[model samples]
Target: MIRFENVSVTYDGAYEPAVQDIDFTVPEGELTLLVGPSGTGKSTVLGAVSGLVPHFTGGTLRGRVTVAGRDTRTHKPRELADVVGTVGQDPLSHFVTDTVEDELAYGMESLGLAPDVMRRRVEETLDLLGLNELRDRPIATLSGGQQQRVAIGSVLTPHPKVLVLDEPTSALDPAAAEEVLAVLQRLVHDLGTTVLMAEHRLERVVHYADRVVLLPSSGARPVLGTPPEVMAVSPVYPPVVDLGRLAGWSPLPLTIRDARRSAGELRERLADIAPVNGRLPHGDTSPRKDPNPRPEVPAPRRFLRRRTTRTAPDTSTPHPAAAVTALAVHRDRVEALRHVELTVTPGETVALMGRNGAGKSTLLAALVGLVEPTRGSVRVGGAVPHRAAPRDLVQRVGLVPQEPRDLLYADTVAAECAAADRDAGAAEGSCRALVSELLPGVGDDTHPRDLSEGQRLALALAVVLTARPPLLLLDEPTRGLDYAAKARLVSILRALAAEGHAIVLATHDVELAAEIAHRVVVLADGEVVADGPTADVVVASPSFAPQVTKVLAPQRWLTVSQVREALSS
Candidate 1:
């Protein structure tokens, strides 16, 4: 249904093509997954399928891209709307209506479909995506994950023959992601719909793909094969495949069930050697305690004083980096968070996890002073966040929000890094160094807006770390990052925590939590449903466990790194 013949794309800039000599064919009624590292033109390839590459994006296409026998070169996106539906990474940019129901119906209305048909399709999409309760909610009031579902449903309602998605499940929780993927599976199997998706979170979608197309690196030719064939040689793969490689299993397993079937002997090998706890090593930082400590301050003071004036190296009796007691926040008459209590000490990492709109992002907002608590108190670095002065707050805490572009205002990346250094009172090139470390090959002259989603996230993170705040907050830190980039990020964050910085990240990436988080705090319906050690919280819950933990069940293993450590010792 989709064919690319010697395709190459180059923007107006003076450089080589973004994608070079990309040729592939995706059969009708099959799901094709596009895999690659950041900035390898996965998005560009998807845009070509929808005719957005050279048409709306102001790029030059050298070859042919056809969808459903319609040449994209001749057919613009609007002309092909009847047969093609495209959903990009940023869902907020795709909406034209105010509410969920309206957004879903907007596409059909544009297509001039009958009102009755449109209504029926809209209801079906809402139920398929589990957006029934949110159908009346405003798009602005919904969470990031909810917005992603609405974006997908808007495209799905049109009943197009082809669906082109970019990071479709990046923002969704595990269960929601599975629901969306299952719906795509039904479309492929029952309705003969075609799907071409590009995603960074391979663990969630690799096994669901009918075929795999890999763009190994920038300007490299594409490699197409079955999932196992491609994953055997592909640079990026999920943890289950990684375990299969480590155990020397033939035909690397793509799913947990396959891995578990071959794990009987491996389980016995690890039975005597307990899996290493995936936490900060003891003696690396301060003495640890339960994350849910009793409240030390009774009232919220505008200018609360620091508990101790000693430096970061002074770990004896160190105060909490951030404290929340009976915290509550209400937005648009909805209780976003209610009576949430938590504490984070210096040199600690915590992950806030839950379903879409379950108060994880809201809690992070309260910590960084973006949202005022309806009740209770929030203290970060010994000062009330909402009332603290801007200058003081910069030194106390820094937040990398869900939308990375929100933190970038400069025209070029170089200018943004310079501005961050000056604002943070840091030496020149500090931000640039962090950027290079996190995401290599990002040029100084490039526009921040032109960077890929993962690249933008890295720039935002570097800007925040330039200030060296005692407390750091990240929302969906690994949204666009591949395994290599995520590993660099884990190394950086671990080093920061060792230097006495407290980290709290709100994310749905269970593999990431399993890798770096010392604690996992699960939220539900604006309340704290569960909070405990990473291994304890994720392993016990079927919804949040990583691939390795699920494969090696009855054993408390959480990550491939832990298993590798145990095997090496």
Candidate 2:
């Protein structure tokens, strides 16, 4: 359905082409996954499919890109709207209307479909994406995952033959991501729709792809093959694929079920091996007690505890780094969080995880003073965060929000880095150096708005880390990051934690929690449902468990590296 023939895209003012001589064909009625590391032109390739690369993006397209036999070179995006539906990385930019129902129908109205057809498609899309309850809700008020589903529903209502999606599941939780992928599967199988998608969360979509297109590097040729054929040598892959490689499994299992089937012997080999930090195997799933002998703080007055943990007392008392006592936050009559008691000391890494709309983001915002608690107090470095001045907040805490664009404003990446250094009063080029280490190969002259979702996130993270605040907060930090970039972030955050930086990250990336989180805090309906050590929390919660944990369950392994180490020893 979509074809790229000797295509190369060179953006204006770019030192080299974004991509070179990319030749591939996404067969009709199939889901094709385009994957590569950060800044490797995956987005550029997706843009070519929808005629946005050289047309709207102000780049030069040298060769041919045809979707449904219509040449993108000759037809602009609007002209191909009936045949192609493109969803960019940022969902906020994709919406033209405010309400969920209106956004879904907007595309059909633009296509001039009959009233009956538009109405029918709108209802069908709402049901298909499981957005029935949210049809009347405002788009801006929805959570990141809900907004993502709405963005996709808007395009699917148009009934285009080809769908080009960039990071469709980055903001979605695992279950929600599965729902979206299942919708795509139905579209391809039931209706023969063609899909060309670029995503960094390969673990969620790699198993469902009909074929894989890999762009290994900038200006490099593409590799096209079956999922395993490409994943065996691909640098970016899911943890399960890594496990298959570690065990030398043939044909490289793509799904967890396949990996589990082949892991019986390996499981037996590591049956006696213990998980890190004394996490029991398939037994004793309760919250682990605090290891320190410090006294526990009582819940604040007038607060009813829904769930509570015994937070370790501040050994270096008189001033705890960060603390939330009986915190309650209400938004639009909805209790986003209630009676939450939490504390973070110097050199601690805490991960907040839960389902969609679980108040994870709200909690992170409260820490950085973006959201004020309706009751109780939130103190960071001995100052109330919501009342602290912006300049003062920057010194005590820094928050990298879910939307990376919020923190980026400069036209060029270099300018943004320079501004970060200036704002944080850091040494010149410090932010630039961090960005280089986090995301290599991205040109300094490139616009931050033009970067892929993961690259933009790296830039935002670098901006936040420039200040080196005593406490740091990240909301969905690994939303669009591939495994390698995620590893780099894990290393950086681990170093920061070791350097006495208290870190709190609200995330849905279970594998990431397994990597760097010293403790896991699960939130539900604005309440802390579970808080414990990482191994105990994740191993008990099957839905939140990492792939290696699932495959080797009953044994309490949390990551592929853990299993690899146990085997090697």
Q: What is the C-alpha lDDT of each candidate?
A: 0.87, 0.83
Model 2 — TM-score against the truth? Answer: 0.90
lDDT of 2: 0.83
Clashes of each: 0, 0
In model 2, where is the ten-residue run with the lowest total lDDT?
292-301
Model 1 Cα lDDT, one tens digit per residue, 1-569: 99999999999874788898999999999999999888788999999999898899987999999999999989999989999999998999999999999999999999999999999999899999999999999999999999999999999999999999999999999999999999999999999999999998998999999999999784668999999999999999999999999999988999999999999999999888765442452235354443211111121121112212324533455578899999999998799999999999888889999999999999999999989999999999789989988777887899999999999999999999999998887788878877776667888988999887778988998899778788999999898888988876777777676657789999999998887787899999999999888878888999999999899998888778777777888
Runs of candidate 2 with Cα error greater than 4 angstroms are 218-220, 276-319, 412-418, 425-433, 436-446
Top-TM-score candidate index:
1
Model 1 Cα shift for residue 263 (angstroms): 0.5
